[model samples]
Target: MGAPFEIGYVFSFLPKLLETLGVTLLIVAGSLLTGIVAGFLVALPRMYKIPVLRTLSGLYLSFFRGTPILIQLFLFYYGLPELLKPLGFDLSRAPVLFFVILAYGLHTGAYAAEMIRASVEAVDRGQVEAAYASGMTSYRAFSRIVLPQALAIAVPVFSNLVIALLKDTSLAFTLGVMEMTGKAQTLGTLTQHFFETYIALALIYLVISFTLEKVLLAAEQRLKRHEAREEKAGRSFKLRRKGSYRAVLADIDAGKGGRL
Candidate 1:
């Protein structure tokens, strides 16, 4: 039979679980960095519609997105070493954390590719044309105008992804990496207080998630403020142009009246 729940034990387990929080965060950070770079590269072929590369990118996305992350984790953690063994390279002795990050990163890249593609597509094409008309190169226009807008559109979604990644780090424990969840499992076993241990773990996750949300929300708001200022400036410029046109028309009427 399971031990009775003890509320006091929850508090006691908190510090022990917190000790491994950094490991969990490290997984998220490493995976996120890897995912962003891979995602952008993967997205490029699709965005430009390159022939063979586009097909390969599509397949990459399909396999990663269609499969469960757990399977991917196993594949990388176990299968990859064997695959590399035939090539005279060995990964059997590599750090477990490395495989964890790689698997998560690849999984994240698949999702991020879609996010990046959609975000970039959401930007107005007319702006790019306008930039072209102003003599800017395609690269310049994209970098200066399109990328900023796309980033603004992407940030909210990316924030959600980050939160998801943070939670997903729990799976890293399956490979015995001793992350937060792994630590909780050990604590629970040692103390025989599964309920309290888990409750403490849940609380830690909640607090971290909440803090991340708030910080990302503030960043989103800051980006929106920049957008707001640009819009205001645009409105003022239009008003000034309108006023100038009116003055020109009035002067033309005065000249015609004098001639009459």
Candidate 2:
């Protein structure tokens, strides 16, 4: 029979699991940074419709987004070294953590690429044309006009991506990286308290996810503050105009009554 359920073990496992939380965060942060840079590079080809590069970027996005992340991790951790051996660039001895970050980054890049492209396209074409007509160069117009709106649109999606990445980091333990999940596994095995250990782990993840949501929500609100204000002002203006029109109609009816 399995070990009896120990509610106390859940509390006991918290500190040990927390010790490895930094590693999980490290993986997320590293992967997020790498994904952003790679995603932008990948997105450019498609955005500009570069001939060969656009095709290549599409294949890249398809491959990464199509495959499961766990498989991608294995490919990077195991298959990459073998593929590189013929090129005289050895990666076999590289740390597992490196492979984990790389795989996660590439996986994240595929999603981020789509997010970035869509956000950029969602910006009004007229605004960009107006910028160009006003003596703005292509780079200047994009930087000054398109990029801000695109970033504002992308923030919410990026926040979601980050949260997903945080959760996905649990899979990194499959590669033997001693992140929080890995630590939990070890604790569970040694104590034979799988139930409590996982409960503790779940609690940790829930708290982290909650905190991230709050922070990212604040950031999203901050970025869209101007848009919110503009929308509010627009609504107010419409209401005022409607009220004035109603008042005018009421005055005309009263004048007709007086004449009658």
Can you write out model 2's per-residue Cα lDDT over 88-198, one digit (the tens) per residue? 989978999999999999999999999999778767787788999999999999999998888887887888899999999999999999999999999988988998999
Q: Which predicted model would earn the best TM-score?
A: 2
Residue 213 Cα positional deviation in candidate 1, in Å, after optimal superposition = 1.1
Kindly list the per-residue Cα lDDT of model 1 for residues 1-260, writing each as its tens digit. Answer: 45898899999999989999989999999999999998999999999999999999999999998998888999899998999999998898999999999999989998899889977876767778899999999999999988987887778889989999999899998999999999999998888999899899999999999999999998887866776686678752211112345334532425446331
| TM values, all candidates | 0.87, 0.88
After superposition, which runs of candidate 2 have C-alpha atoms over 4 Å from their true positions?
A: 236-260
Query: Best-fitting candidate, measured by lDDT?
Result: 2
Local lDDT at 44 for model 2:
97
